[model samples]
Target: MPPPFPSRAEIEADQLEQLRALVTELFPANAFYTRKLEDCGVTFDVASLADFSRRFPFTTKAELVADQAAHPPFGSNLTYPLAAYTRFHQTSGTTGAPLRWLDTPESWAWLRELWTRVFTAAGVTAADRVCFAFSFGPFLGFWMAFESAQQLGCLCLPTGGMSSAARLRLLLDNGVTTLCCTPTYALRLGEVAREEGLDLGRSRVRRILVAGEPGGSLPAVRARIESLWPDARVRDHHGMTEVGPVTYECPAQPGVLHVMESGHYAEVIAPATGQPVSPGETGELVLTPLGRVASPVLRYRTGDLVRPAAVRAACVCGTHELALAGGILGRTDDMVIVRGVNVHPAAVEEILRAAGGVAEYQVTVTTRGPLAELALAIEPAADAGDATALARKIGGALETALGLRIPVHTVAAGSLPRFELKARRWHRAGK
Candidate 1:
């Protein structure tokens, strides 16, 4: 049987012990960590969280990438021999070159446990049928999610190698009660449902757990998906190939995601200063994997920007930790400045979804002279008015939401690309 999910306090205490043990185990064996820990005068036996925090230096993707390049295949971060690892996976390469990640059997089980929390939080039960809408690949798309369903005793339905229409058929035919996919793909599936004239709202699915993008928490995006699947509830989750599923949405709180600090240590720091920021302040998310021993990361900076809030009010779900206010507002890298105003693609997506005339949209940033401009190409609804009228509505909505004027251009339906994975909605011309 799987271990019962521990409370935040319990997880923290357990992690503290694990941290000390891992430090000792890796210190002499792994040169990368040995140098990192030794430089900070941190020994393997830390007695408190504060002591551990002070001992470990911040880990960055750039450093990991550099190490991988220096030592091909697996980086020098490995504490044990390469033969000890039983599983291999890689990053999505959405940000850069995919960094290969390996895990021992024990660590792989921990990954499943993290995902099990995801399923449980989304109200997944043994009686339910869970369908994964992912192309089985090295990117860790839904491989763990599939394994998690089995761990939870749920019937797993693999949608790999099937078309959207076929997946829809399987979903309806199998009475699937839950779905796991990227937020982009959920919307894409909705689009496919409309094309096939299938009433998705009436489908048997009761819940959807989405990750890989901020669309799950965007009001308009969430609203649109809920509108299409009336009986289904949409929940957001956050994870990375290097870090397992470390945060998930609680049904009690609609849009907020609770970070599982028991199995991980999470911190929000000013992106520029690298200093800890107060609660409710937007900052870069830095994570430490407390349970993933095979390739544990300490203070790894995740480019995701989030505002963390202290858990004061008791939640309906019981487990307590920090919660992200709006579930990954946007990535620090994805933020753009247009006409002296900051814009996140999610902000634009929220406005477009609320306006209701857009079928699809793309935001492009280009430099003309010394000024940066924001231009949008949108596919208007079938019954919507002319392109100019739709454009005006979009511009007004954006202005109201962002306090900035943006140009919206109506484009032919299907002109802009649709995404099944991460949606590259915003393009920055010339790097």
Candidate 2:
């Protein structure tokens, strides 16, 4: 059985203990954290979470980037010596330069254990044939997931580098009962299955586990994926390379997700001020992955927008771990102010997804003029005709929903590039 989440009181005590231990373990050998903590007048005698938050400075991507640049290859975030480390992984470099992260044998094992719990939360077992449908690379996306699924005693199939059709064939031929991929790739596979005349709805696959994007949490997008595979359920997994698996969509609550409070500490703070938001109010997600001495992120700012879950709400999972209202609303950095009207691409995506005729769409922000402008390009579904009319309708609908006039263009069928990994949905000028 999976490790049950501890209660709030247990989490508070455990987190403080872990925080103290982390400080002791890292401050000795890790120059990066030692300087960071000491500069802020922080010490081992930190009393509460509030004290920890106030005394310790928040870790940002810019600092990590600068640190790595100063120290080539891997940064000096390691508590243990290089000889003590065994694992190597890196970030996707989505925002800027790719951050090269190293882990000690202990920390590597930490990640493996965390992933096992993640898989178990998704209800995977040895009997399930898990097919990894991700494009494997240096990216840490499903690399750990593949390893952890194997740990679950399941038949782990690595379909990396294989074509969509080939992957579909592997899933069907091998009796793959569960799939692990990004939400975009899952939908791409559905499109391929339709094109290849393969009925995915009748396949043996029963669960679709998705990560690396907000699509899984979107009811409209989740519904579309679920519709493609009739009996299959879509589970959303949220985490980052810096932070180990932090949260997973629970089977007990269905759409509601619980954070891995036992493994990591979480806080919801105002994106600009770093102050804790009011209960149930939206804020940026600040994470602290405990026990990762080799590459520990102390009160790291994740830039992910989220809301704190209420206490004693809905069906309790027997473990009263902190729950998230809607998993990852959007990224604080990704939110754009379009002509005085603030907009998140995800908000637009939600509207487009609900509109129903879009097969695939991309949002482009043009900074060519004094005022920032937004445009939408979409490929209409096969059955949907009158592309011009559809685009016009979508444009009008976006105007109504966003309270701003935005231009919408129709792209020819199969013109828009499809993504196998994280979808690059935004195209900006003068970056």
Candidate 3:
């Protein structure tokens, strides 16, 4: 159950108090934020969340990347001395060069506190074996999940660099009940299980928590994953390397995720105007993690599109937590205009997935003179016959669904690249 707060005003008052303390401490200790905040004439003593958000100046990935380059290795985001920093991780660098993140002992422990809340929300217990199928690299993903599972006293099983078949064997042999991996990797594991003649639905696994991508939120993708492991429940978790675990799906509500307000402030703004959007309206998500002072993000533009709920809206789970009704609508920069029709890759995915007969697909946009050309490389499902026929069927469905006729071609199964983490399905042919 959520903390029984009287009203949204109380949440803001508490958050503002916390934010004031954080800024007051950060402005003097953290060079990166100090310079940014001081240059903007933002005082450490803030009166309200509105004043802070409006005056603090938005941080961007580009600025962070440049700072790391100028500072060498780790940037000056640290609020404490170098000796106080113990844990080191980095962003995935999917957008550009990776941003190195250093966490102090206090901040690392802070991450554990957060993951514990989310882990409990996902219904994880000490007796449940949380087998992480992640690569467990320095990307700040599975490392946090693994360490936090230890804090929870759950058996943290690492399956890094192990084949899907081996992972399946390990999970079954150990009677693992909880599984964590990317949504693409989960589906890939299911594919491998089917090819190896294994039954995952009968396995002891009962809950699947997928992050690093938006697949778990897609209706077709979620349905497929749940069908693969019929006894298991699939839920989506949204987090960032720069920002620790921030939002998670409500177990009672399947499509939306409630923003855990314990240590973060979330807002939605129109992408073009940079103005706050009304409740139920779609806009980009901006977050400010009140803790994580060692490497804080102040009103960082997340680039994720969302439809934020009403301030007093409470999910069916009986928690009056803020929720994004549609987990992540799409990326602000991911929209591609084809023949003057704006198309979001996620919406395209929905159409193709619902059409059926596709195991995997990749999207590529090429520059054709003055306009963008969209092309799809589709891999047919195992049970489907005549790959060309499947592609044609999906193409027709997509044209009808997206209201545009784009090219769709069939690719041989096992030919396209497979992803273990966040899948890079969309790519621009030319820079």
lDDT tens digits by residue: candidate 1, 202-300: 689999889988889888888888877779889899899878887889677888888877678787889998888888789999888876767888888
lDDT of each: 0.83, 0.83, 0.84
TM-score of each: 0.94, 0.95, 0.96
RMSD to native, candidate 2: 2.0
Cα lDDT of model 3 by residue, 243-320, tens digit? 788788887888788777777888789978888999889899888888888888888888988888865555677776
Which pairs of residues clash in candidate 2, taking residues 3 or more apart in a chain or in different chains?
A: none
> Best-fitting candidate, measured by lDDT?
3
Name the regions of candidate 3 deviating beyond 4 angstroms.
1-7
**Taking the tens digit of each residue's C-alpha lDDT, what string does model 2 give over 1-431?**
74555556777899899888887787668889888877876775678877888888889989998999998888878787788877777888889999988877788778888888878988899998999987778776577898888878999999878999999998988889999988888888888898899988668988999988888888878888887787899999788889878888877766567788778888889987888988689899899998787889988999988877756443366767677777878899888888788898778877887777788998888886566888789999776789998898899889898899888999999999898877888989764
lDDT of model 3, residue 241: 81
